[model samples]
Target: MNTTANHTSPPAPRVSKTRRRLPVLILAALLAAVPAHHALADKNDHIEARELLKRGEIVPLARILEVVQQRVPGDVIEVELEREDGLWEYKVKVLTPTGRVRKLYLDARNGVVLKIKDD
Candidate 1:
């Protein structure tokens, strides 16, 4: 009797091609969706701005300019309301204490300073 034990070859290494592709596919889909999502978000933000204006929640453009000028005590080169991340806010470009251009963002509803970027 030949004592030869049957040696079963180890199972082949599993190559999870689908699993690897899943993350890649998800990333590609998200990248492709970003621009479309941004465009829709912008459109919605515009609608929100119109609604806020109708509701009188936003200060008048001229009034905002006056307030910024009064508070900053400088010449305002430009005053405009910008929508960022779907929220409407004010941006004031002013010449500040050192005579350098500065940009500030204020809350549209309450006139509170949200941000100030100075040169």
Candidate 2:
């Protein structure tokens, strides 16, 4: 009988504990962050018009009265926007530049002077 050389198979490659756990941990973290991001985006997306009005975008009543006093050179006792008969208009009651109580109507769309009554 002839003696033959014995061949042995190589061992399987080893996987580190850290490498196996890291990917699963990272995937779990990413999934958790997704819903939190969506909730934040939804909360900030829309605002109401009434809420906007309170936040100083629309003209303030005090400032409008001040402008009337400066331009007309008299005390503006009252200012209001009212629907008159069937029309929407700004009704401004002022102690005029001439020291008379005057009522004026301004066109809402263009701010053009419409009518003036001094009393």
Candidate 3:
């Protein structure tokens, strides 16, 4: 009861545990979903490719490789099939004996070489 004055400050705001964990949970869920979606898309693409092959719509990869080897005469390294503008194409990468790389683009339906690029 002397000349001392009481100074009372407001308490700090409280944050619930759920509120703090919400952002983390949302981020984790998003990260988990992306891979599943990508995997599903990949599986679908594979099924479609198999169906096309069975229907004789697209040439077999083995035949395409044979055609490519006959034309380029190299060790085939990589190959990919793609559908562009409603037409299927095969991209083949070859490593030549002279240590050069060549990219060959072919028609997937007929195994016809459409274009070639050397590197």
Candidate 4:
């Protein structure tokens, strides 16, 4: 009878609980920061818009709505202030008496109607 010894490699080192949780904790932190960053950005946008209005760079919504009403007699539904091609514009949507919606693009600085489209 021959005596043979079975040689097995030692088990790998066990990972600590903190080491396992490091990646998860980092991911959670990154996810939490995303919404906070967005909130700060939204607040900054409001501040910039207010500054523009105060500086007369962009006209007020009330004035823009008045101009829109004269051209399209409808219930004002929605309005959005957007910047395009380095120019500020007001995109206005109106629901007309004929049950049709019209989208109006206007120059935000002076409330000049730039284009109107039926929707």
Model 2 global lDDT (CA atoms, 0 to 1) = 0.48
Order of candidate numbers by lDDT, starting with the best? 4, 3, 1, 2
Q: Superpose all Cα atoms of candidate 4 onto the true structure and report the RMSD in Å to 1 decimal.
A: 18.9
TM-score of each: 0.50, 0.40, 0.63, 0.63
Error of 1 at 24 (Å): 49
Cα lDDT listed for each candidate: 0.60, 0.48, 0.69, 0.70
Q: Which stretches of candidate 2 lie over 4 Å from their true place?
A: 1-67
**Candidate with the greatest TM-score versus the true structure:** 4
Q: By descending TM-score, how would the candidates be arranged?
A: 4, 3, 1, 2
Q: Write the per-residue lDDT of candidate 4 for residues 1-119, one digit (tens) a residue.
A: 76888889999999975576455434322222122124333434655666778899988766887898899986766666667777878777788889999999899899999999997
As for candidate 4, its clashing pairs are none
Top candidate on lDDT is 4
Q: After superposition, how far is residue 83 of candidate 1 from its true place, in Å?
A: 1.5
Q: Write the residue-wise lDDT of candidate 3 on 45-103 in tens digits.
A: 65566677888888877788789889898766666676667777777788887899999
lDDT of 3 at 34: 24
List the lowest-lDDT window of 10 residues for candidate 4: 28-37
Tens-place lDDT digits, model 1, residues 10-60: 998886745644554343222221222253333345455556667977765
Clash pairs, model 2 backbone: none
- Tens-digit lDDT string for candidate 2 (1-119): 86987889899888775465455434322221122224323332223212323563334333444445555665555554443555434556766546778877664334456777775
